[model samples]
Target: MVVLRTGPVAVGGVTLGNHLILAAGVLGTTGASLSRMLARGAGGVVTKSIGPEPKNGHAGPCVAVLDNGILNAMGLPNPSQDFTGELGSLGQKPVIVSIFGGTPEEFAEVAGWFKGTAAGFELNLSCPHAEGYGAAIGVDPVLVEACTRAVSTLGMPTWVKLTPNVTDITAIGKAAERGGATAIVAINTVKAMRISTALRRPVLGNRYGGLSGDAIFPVAVRCVYELFESCKIPIIGCGGVSTADKVVEMMMAGAQAVEIGSAVQRDIGIFETITNELYAKKGIEPGEIVGCAHE
Candidate 1:
């Protein structure tokens, strides 16, 4: 048996066995896949960012792997918060409902949909190619703060997901804190572009997309570190984390937990492998390692 040394971490009143969490991706856009991931041993799961109602999103070939990370312009395609109540019936694992809205009131409405479900809410104010409500709200500290505070009154953990494209990430990180966020998911995808020599145009149909993967590690680390020094709430470090060492690095930067985004491209078992490897090497239970590096 693999003795995993993950580490104890708490978010919104729930104790996580380990710090490893799967970031929101295409999985939860559908109910079936979301059900499968919860069964696969993921400590916590973030649903793909959803809007108040249905959104068709941008066109695909949505994801393109670059030399470093992956660029995607999925445009926050989701079934909206209407189906969120059903999430509470999924299973035992904590469910964090990721949401996007055009206004503070709209965000509150979407968040309220989880009144009887979801352990928390992740405010996705940062998606590069997502139309209208994506990166716009995140670029403004006041807007981010307003939205965070609006949903926070629900008595559930509210996390503001920040965008790295900004020159100063700490500003927004602090703003999220001021608005009473339980946590902040640092460094959402950076705006990026790729050109195809054959096509002589942008590779992604959306022209620009959010970048994620190993390429984003340095930036994500800096943002996490900055927030650690500036804010008191727990931080969920995400972006470009593919190995156990990177996971440890994020912890040192003051992240209470780490979310693996593009690493899923490696394999579904990649998370299990990394957690098992950390466990084998440290000879500690997964819960014992959560934010050890930072402490």
Candidate 2:
């Protein structure tokens, strides 16, 4: 049996077993998958961003593997499923449902559907490639605040996921805080694209996609740092975190919790590896290192 070390870390008033969380859009579409992650030692899970209505996403050739990372124009594909029902299936594990929409009313409507079941809601105002969704709403502080306000009234902790594609991320973070968000998830995937050499055409069917993986680690840290400086709420750092060292680095950069996404795709057991490493090698609890670097 694995003797997991326990370190309590609180985000948005909800306490988690540790600081390591599963990022949105990776390995958390269903309750079963989330259960698997919980068994693997993940502190919590954030489901893939679901819209008000079902989205078919984009066509084939949506993902392109780059030298340093991966680009995907998934277009936020998701089936019309009951999000609250899925959250209930995760048992006692904390689950934050990621929701998206084109308008503030749409965002509120979707969030209302899952109000009581979720531990919290992540307002995905910052996906770069999705049309009428994601970054389109995220870049404008007015829209970000409006969307956040619409969901904040649901009586659940709300986190606004911000996009790095903007010129000033702190402005967006402040806007989210002003709208009553409990926390801000700094730095979603960066906007980028690639072309297929053989076909001499855009790689993704959508012509562009969000870049994720190791390449975005620094950018993520920067955003987290800036948000921490500007906003009073907690910050959840996510980008290309695959190792315990990266987790620590993110916390030092001022993230109360770090979300793992692309790294899990390479190895499902990464959560265990990171937690074990933090205990054995560093001899420091995960919560102990939150914002250590700033001091």
Candidate 3:
């Protein structure tokens, strides 16, 4: 059996059971859904990436699946902070608020709100489909550093989620490290789109969307490995993980924890299914798969 190896994995002073983490997903968009994930045994929860203010985001048909990944153009539509405040008191599970903004100051302000409440903060530095700020911040090392530093003063673990569209993911990875990020979430969705040839338009309403799914697993793994090779910090892997086997693969690639983005919609009980499999395979504990690659 794959017994989960035990170790201390602390983020901003909160110790998680093991490295088995559920990545941020749609469930995180609402406080009710977040509470349920905790009930289902997720180590912690990352809110759906939010912007500084309420955003209408893109219209429906925002998400599409590609051969290897999923494409999403959801405009980061989120209930405003005032409406989401109840999230702070919803459950005991550590909450790592994910926020996006057009400038460093805006991100810092968002970080400021989470002080004394959220367990950590993950800056959505990369979101392929969002306009201006999403992928733009991640492609430039200087901007990445500036944005990270701006939010560093929040006195919590700040993780910069990177984009895969860059030429060298490691460059921005290291830049974030230099800017004082506590850890790195190795990748946001990759940009890809499906088009409607008959309509002479993109399949998604936004004309383009991010691609994420089983097909992107290899790409996610490679990006995680490359970031691990370049920097020494806990890495949060997200993308195309729908089973315990994929979870193990991510651990071997050096992810301290993994996120379950689009997979939440794959099956309502998928988390329990995968968690049971991990335990059945002797991976009940978190960080247990740290050295799985060498074995």
Q: In angstroms, how far off is 132's CA in candidate 1? A: 1.9
Q: State the lDDT at 213 in candidate 3.
A: 80
- Candidates in order, TM-scores: namely 0.91, 0.94, 0.91
Question: Clashing pairs in model 2?
Answer: 127-134
Per residue, candidate 3 scores C-alpha lDDT tens digits across 74-120 of 87887657645757566456777888888899998887876777777
List candidate 1 stretches off by more than 4 Å. 1-8, 85-88, 280-295
* Candidate 2 structure quality by residue, lDDT tens digits, 90-148: 66568888999999999989888887778889999889988899999999999999999
Give residue 288's error in model 1 in angstroms. Answer: 9.0
Reference-based lDDT, each prediction: 0.79, 0.86, 0.77
Q: Which structure among the candidates has the greatest TM-score?
A: 2
- 57 Cα displacement, candidate 3 (Å): 1.0
Specify the highest-lDDT model's number.
Answer: 2
By TM-score, rank the candidates, best first: 2, 1, 3
Q: Determine which window of 10 residues in candidate 3 has minimal summed lDDT.
A: 11-20
Question: Pairing residues by index, what is the TM-score of model 2?
Answer: 0.94
lDDT of 2 at 286: 54
Model 1: per-residue Cα lDDT over 72-115, one tens digit each: 88888777756765575566557778888999999999988876
Error of 2 at 12 (Å): 1.2
